[model samples]
Target chain A: MRAELFLQYLVSGLIYGSIYAAVAIGFNIIYNATGIINFAQGEFAMLGGMIASSLASRLPLALAMAAAVAATTLVGIGMERAFLRRIARGGVLKMIIATIGLSIAIREIALLIWGESVRTLPFFSGTEVSSVGIAGAHFSPQVFWVLGVTALVVAALTAFFKLTLIGKAMRGCSANREGASLCGIDPDLMVTLAFGLSAAIGAIAGCAVAPLTQTHYAIGTGLGIKGFTVAAFGGLGNSLAAVGAGLILGMLESFSIIVVPEAYKDVVSIVVLLAVLFAKPSGIFGSRAAGALKDY
Target chain B: MLKARNLEAGYGPLRVLKGLSLHVAPGEIVAIIGANGAGKSTLLGSLAGLVRPTSGSVTLRGEDVTGSRPERMLAAGCSLVPEGRKLFAPMTVRENLELGGYSVRRRLGRKAFEEDLAGVFELFPRLGERQGQLAGTMSGGEQQMLAIGRSLMSRPELIMLDEPSMGLAPLVIKQIFSAISALRSRGKTVLVVEQNAKAILKIASRGYVMETGSLVLEGTGQELLANRDVQRAYLGKEYSSIADEREGR
Candidate 1:
């Protein structure tokens, strides 16, 4: 491959990779807190993009994005309180199925509200024609926004889980719910917060990538699968590893177009996901002993 | 500081605790000793709000906290060191201790929280030295100490321990019992359940002998330790031989 083409693919991979990483982090947050793979996670991103674009006409872009994130967060909290919490004793499998139902419901509702037409947020800094040239490759400024926001979100979440009292309590809940409750840390509250936090992060990623990928009501399913693939590849429940896994998957998908047709690009991630599941269900970064202990 | 009255709790139809009642006064060490299936752990679970009572009341510091959630129980200044320690294995000792104080942190403010952390470290200097070590990586005895220290971090007026000596060496059991004795000096009330009747009865001011979910005998530790039935049922070969001889075996 030519150097310029390779740079373009690399930039494209990084952009998608960061978005996948954000989505995987969302998965990790909820998984760590509640041990449920929330299938509706990607819909949170779709909701952010759709809501922000709709509100952009009436509100400033930044304000619109913030409102969208907040609204999505509320939706996430409601999902937990109204649905997940109610059937919590039903065990993890039932809860996972419920999330799948929720994802379909959200997608259908979004379709009703936003129609089938694709929408995109305006470029964060410069117009579509504007580009920053590096070496021989040119890229839009929005690429920086996507990368910067993802990095910021990762750092903030890392700090939150590591340093804050509530964050430690949340970790306590995930580590041992009964133990946490005995310590006077409410597991239910932590789980609800997990849902809200994951949704907020998802929304931010959704909004960041909207200008480049364009938002459609049906985008969530694809994004959800890709994000899950990254999460599983990185070793579920390990967020930092998810970022690396996301980048690797993204790069593979981006570069796969050289050998396979663009239409078959999605096949690359699916193959990776299947291979990881079959060969090392615990994930690439997860220890064999630790993986054996987890339910996957 | 803690009272449980007519408590009826169980898992499904099993009925582990059948209308059991117990109380611990402020600054007292009350020990409950029974066989493996005697529902001692269940009693602690119900009192600490881990298991909801089908019928009864749990009072903490003059407040009727029956059937309240665990966090509410903690907020009311009651903490339980559950069976097997139940430490957050992945977290550090400091993190575990910090989380134990979660319910009162906002109410007590940052300074008090820090003090409580320092106080826990003081109680278990081993924990202090290994503050950065993961809870799961600790030895059984250190983990038990961490569990007790974590409970103390909440500054709980009433602390309930379920089988603190379940799986410890004789020396470790002595260390844990000494720590329980020390809690009385600090003016904290303790309700400890144990299968090691002799050891717990040594430091306990009062003790109860439970069998099949009912307290068959209750008395001062010395009286219970000297009781023929308690000796026969719980104290094992040495005392059981004496009791057996008294009963004409």
Candidate 2:
């Protein structure tokens, strides 16, 4: 590829990578706190995208995104209360089965409600060329949204964990369930709260990125797999590490067009995942057990 | 004050506390001494609402509290420092205490919580010093101190400690036993279960001997210490468990 083409790819990869980072952060939170990979996370994203698309048809861009995220968050809360609460005590086997079943069920419901056709977000930025270079590599407002929102999510999540009592309680529950109970924390409450928080974040990412990739009901499986792979490649239950890994994966996928075909980009992330499993088993920046997120 | 009458409790199908009965007066130190698997821990678990009793009642201050949720009981002024010194290992000593006092702190204003925090620190100076140190990284003795201190944070009217001296050095055990006694002097009631019968009786105002889910003996600390049957069974070789068995003959 020529220099201009390479620069374009670089810019595109960096922007896409930022969106992946936000999604990975949400995955890490649920995985760390509940010891279960909520496969429906991508569905949350898809829901956000769909909701944003429908709302933006009439409402302002920012307001549409907000409403979409709020609606998806409520869906997450309902899923936790309806599905997770009953099956939490169903042990590892039953809970795993329940979540897997719920994932399929959610995907089907999305397809039924939103239809199987892909839907794109409306033009958030007017048709304006905002570029300084002679090549006119204009920056779209969608690209800016993806980059800025990812940074904000990371900062907000970090602060919540550090400064809040409820956040500490969630951490405590994740570390040791029996001991947390002894400390007077209700483990069930913590688990439900975590699910709710993770879902909301997933929705935000979905809504933010919809204007670019659009969303379809059947899109959940591929996105869900990518989110999990990104999370696992980084560190199964490490939020910061997951975000970093997601960005790296995103860049790999976007940049592979130069060295090889676009398909080869995913190969980098997959290889990293295998290497971590074979060598460290915990990925970078994670402990052996990574059992931090299992109980509450 | 606390009372357990006809307290029949068990883990699942197997009964552990078979019609066991005991009581403690206000500002009293009562020790329950028994052999391993003597249902001592089970009794405490039932009292703490960690285990459900098959039958019988546990009353605190003449109020029926059998099978109450642990958190509700904790807020109602009943706290248990469970076996194995179950502190949040990843958390610091202060975090552990904060969790202990979580329910209590909800009712008190910020200032009162701070004062109570200081009071616990006064009782266990090491906890104050190690506030930022992870509970898991602390030595066995220090963890034990933090466990007791954590229970104190709840400001429970009745503190039930399960084997506080387990796995600790001899010196540490002495310090812990002394601290239990000090709680009584502070007008707080304490119920401790221990295998060290001799040391327990020394500090307790009254004592009960449990064996395989039954209360075998109960009396003043001095009386039980002198009984012959108790001498043969527990109290070790250093002191006879009991002087005689006064069975109805």
Best candidate per lDDT, number? Answer: 1
- Candidate 2: list runs displaced more than 4 Å: A1-11, A123-138, A288-296, B238-249
The number of clashing residue pairs in model 1 is 0
Q: How well is each residue in A163-202 modelled by candidate 2, as lDDT tens digits?
A: 5667777777777776667667787888878877887888
DockQ values, each candidate:
0.67, 0.42
**Off by more than 4 A, model 1:** A289-296, B238-240, B243-249
Query: What tens-digit string does per-residue lDDT give for candidate 2 at B1-249?
Result: 899999998866788899988999998889899999999999999998888888999999998999987876786788888998777787778887877777667678566667878988888898999899988778999998898888888888899999999999999999899888888877789999998888888888999999899988888889877776666678554332122234422
Q: Each model's C-alpha lDDT?
A: 0.91, 0.79
Model 1: colliding residue pairs:
none
Candidate 1 lDDT at A201 equals: 95
TM-scores for every candidate against the unseen true structure: 0.97, 0.91
